[model samples]
Target: MAKTACDHDVLIVGAGISGIGMAAHLEMMCPGRDYAILEARENLGGTWDLFRYPGIRSDSDMHTLGFVFEPWRHEKSIADGPSILEYLNRIVDERGIRQKISLGTKVVSANWHSDRACWELVVDKGGSRQTITANWLYLGTGYYDYDDPYDAGFDFSAFQGQVVHPQFWPDDLDYTGKNVVVVGSGATAVTLVPSMADKAASVTMLQRTPTWMFSRPAKDALANFLRRILPEETAYKITRWKNVFMQDKSFKTARNKPEKVKQFLHKKIQKALGDHYDPASFTPPYDPWDQRLCLVPDNDLFEAMKRGKAQVVTAHIDSFDATGVKLKDGRHLPADIIVTATGLRLAVAGKITVSQDGTPVDFAQRFYYKGCMFSNLPNLAVVFGYLNASWTLRADINSEYVCKVLNHMDAVGANVAMPYLADDHGLEEEDLFDFSSGYIQRGKHLMPKSATTLPWRLNQDYRVDKKALAEAPIDDGIMRFDHVDQRTQQQLEAAE
Candidate 1:
């Protein structure tokens, strides 16, 4: 298990924010490590490149969403898709990470050889199968299934109108001057309704249940003021911390004082919608932050409703007629186009088949270790973002933590590092994600198990994780590190 036996020191899947961020961290932390990024799509930006639906923008502020290494100079903190893509592109180009990216290369399966202490990846490139080996496998592939979104089981067979899913939005589809009906009440639906309202003859957001919505200006005034007064990186750091603090406080308040938070949110929405605000359509069955709240920048959605361009209907779908949707309440809504803003289908490890030796690894059975690695898994890390805050917040910490682990292995002259758990560890299993969102609930079985204790659970709190992941000692009692020669000698002795 020599280092020369592997093609590269690291193989990063998906050339999106997470992959690019990991590469940047490696360049800064582990200078000489050889790494390659494999992206299935031809483009580099993962989510930004995949989604082309109109009015697509970041629900979170850019200061927190953008990488800590890079400063977001854009005027709008809540930027659109193209702007975000530009920011990512700048990062890769400036960091010299662009050259290491392999476009149109898909990693189909990864098998870890314990004896060799490396990962053998079978990939599909240009419809041809090829094998690549690496010492470490870092999956930056997002949680959602790229090939398919969550199916709401809508029957549109008899509908003559065009139906489209936001995941695979057609570039040529036009809904101008046509009645459009968007299904679901999550972020996607909330974003689509007002975006389509400008040109559509009528835009209706059809939801089975309402989602909590909050409105704010897209541009951050304080951030802009600070940027003018201070250096770019300095301002970015300050703004980043400020937003992070506010986000944590808001989330905690929502959890601790749901009723008070709900009233505050209701008041905000009422101010925006005014005469158009209806409790039935605006109020969700759950409390704030129970599911991620929908962000409406500058009250755009409410403005559209006030202008009579967009409307919200709280009802269940009965079926689809030739012209439109029929409500379960015996009401018919006419539409020429139906956009299924339905949620995403969650997938673990980018749907890649992961195995140890020749046996497949079921993530659901393994305990999550430090929100990055899994128990009993060696030299592998996956980035899953925070549910309550900006995704990059988690990605940044995870990338830095993985770099620390790699450096620790080098310092100790260990070829393999794994979090080892005994068969009867007596750890109680808890839900990995605490969200009641449909996507989380539906995909719980595919996710790794979480324990009640630290280092064994996938923590959602950024403040807690930042301190633990950054400053914690690498050689904890649970993590086993072994040199190749030592491992071989142990194997020989065991065989004897």
Candidate 2:
């Protein structure tokens, strides 16, 4: 077997949690594998580094969100953006992954060459374009669009006040002593309403439709207690598993008994808001887990409402008047600053133009293989995290699985490994993501196709994925492996 000439064995896009996690797995599982992380931004940390909005924090708990290799020592389980960024920076530095990262280098396009069994990547760095080749391409780029956020098509030109989006929050903008109105009722809106309420004269969350809101303490009492009695690694592992189990069970329960979960959530909200609680404002039209539940840490949003510092207005925006937003119900909300915390615009393969032997690869037309690789896509794995649980949980398992595939390829003297999807394959195509979140619904067309069974769809359950991804054989009958020299021979055999 002969190895192809390439710049690196593996080229990972995005220096965020997914990319960093993949590199770490490669180091531990497949030592001496040459790899480089290409980050488009000038800095790393991905979403954490990108979002600097008020009250920017993780909706998910840190015990499960943190990498399995590293233990989260933060007292706050739902950590702030800066704290999460610090955690990521520490991992890169400690693991010597920082040196391998190429900041400001963005992968614009990637083409797979079957003849050489390698990927040619076109990257842009400071307006200069360059090409790099690698035996394997791993996309750790997150699901959302970095350049463009979801546009709700709100006409803010008529409004006299300043309008901003949370995706590209201005660092110098100050809303102190000014009335602020945040649009939409997603996680971002919930987070911003309470955070801005502290300094703003009045903060109002304007929503078209209500979203399921749940409140919990920012700090994990059991996790803190476990840390006091146990070693850091052991305590972290126990807490992580406990959170994973709870998350899975909660999601399942919500799907199974929506009414029960809805009542439980409403009770918590009522307890926090007291007299301020409005069933119409807190209750969503759909079931609990239809979309992600908005996490209100320490009852911050409810506290703000109770204190008269913040309010939740459920109405459709007819238009933005000079004074403020004009509601369809004939109400005008005065606002000095408007923050559009609408939602994210989902993207696939980091919006990179992917091609196979000069033929454009449309992910939506292809099937997702094992939640990592795509059908007929060789030597490539894209990390798409679990929507129901922590993003890192899926990332961790996907990284390990990719490493296993790489090692298996090496053992078999194979240069290319592609999941073959035949025309007559009986796999039924299903929605890639089950969530009815606005972003998911809007971006469904751009996502890869999913089947009804395992290894053909992206499993949202981390517990099931953990076992399957770990124990599943790398050389599954569906995946075709061949050496560089055998490519032509295999193609000829397939043609016949």
Report the C-alpha lDDT of model 1 over 405-481, residue by residue, as the tens digit: 88888887887889999999999878778889999999998999999989998888999999998777888898898
Candidate 2: residue pairs that collide:
none
Candidate 1 clashing pairs, residues 3+ apart or interchain = none
Off by over 4 Å in 2: 486-496
Cand. 2 TM to true fold: 0.97
CA lDDT scores, all candidates in order:
0.92, 0.92
Per-candidate TM vs. native? 0.97, 0.97
lDDT tens readout by residue for model 2, 1-496: 1366677899999999999999999989989889999999999999999999988999999998999999999999999999999999999999889999999999999999887788999999999999999999999999999999999888888899999999899999989999999999999999999999989999999998999989999999999999999999999999999999999999999999999999999999998889999999998999998999989999999999999999999999999988899999999999999998889999999999999999999999889899999988899999999889999998899999998888888888888999998888988877778888999999998888989899998888898888898788888798898988745655776899
**Model 2 residue 474 distance off true place after TM-score fit, in angstroms:** 0.8
Off by over 4 Å in 1: 1-4, 485-496
- RMSD (Cα, Å) of model 1: 2.5
